[model samples]
Target: MNDSARAKPLPTPETQHYWDGAAAGELRLQRCQACSKAYFPPRPFCPACGSRGVRVFAASGKATLYSYIINHRAAPGFTAPYAIAVVQLAEGPRLMTNIIDCPQTPEALVLDMALEVAFQKLDDTITLPVFRPAGA
Candidate 1:
């Protein structure tokens, strides 16, 4: 599918840094300074302690395949048989993404399989952080 046909992300002030990091080939996440907990879906306040002291930093880009589902039905921007996955980042946060560079099958996408971040640039401003086998 073409880039224009894909559903793009709308970057907000709270999440702008994340999108920027993806464009730079780095996976960035927010950590609560007060609680020292890493989290996804960036926000000004820490969800654990309600503290507004949150810092954005580069993630290790290392993750594991926590869970996934193979979608047989195609969407506007996605092809069928794609794995919609939840990857657990090394820092303790999980994010929904697509698994690429591998066959989309249950036997192939094993739970706890090592994976790493792979950016998919949808446009000049929107780059998605997908995942693939760690060494692939």
Candidate 2:
């Protein structure tokens, strides 16, 4: 498996904006106008209030590692070991992403570690938002 196969993204009508933002080297999140709550996995309406007044905005690309699990088994196109993490963005949304550019070991994946976004372009249309140790 190649990077292209591993880089496939799930895009829905509601998430097209997010994928577009990633393509442009930007991180975007959806905010509800009614409740002013920022959320991830962009949806058609606000999850908190069920309002359709959701807007997309760019994020600061700063986050902290909330939790993670190290996978030693290699999946198709994935390396033998990698860290799949849930990162808490500075904007208050938690996103499920992969942590990159560091040793994928329990000793290196410290909880609450600060991280920054690093875009990995898989192909012409897809880009992945991976995180690395902040300032590394």
Q: TM-score winner among the candidates? A: 1
Among residues 3 or more apart in sequence or in different chains, the pairs in candidate 1 whose N, CA or C atoms overlap within 3 Å are none
RMSD of each: 0.9, 1.3
Q: In angstroms, how far off is 28's CA in candidate 2?
A: 0.6
Candidate 1, backbone clash total? 0
lDDT tens digits by residue: candidate 2, 21-133: 99999999989999999998889899999999989999999999999888888787788778889999999999988888889899999999999998988778888888999
Q: What is the lDDT of candidate 1?
A: 0.92
Clash pairs, model 2 backbone: none
**Backbone clashes per model, in order?**
0, 0
TM-score of model 1 vs. true structure: 0.96
Over 4 Å off, model 2: none
Ten contiguous residues minimizing lDDT sum, candidate 2: 1-10
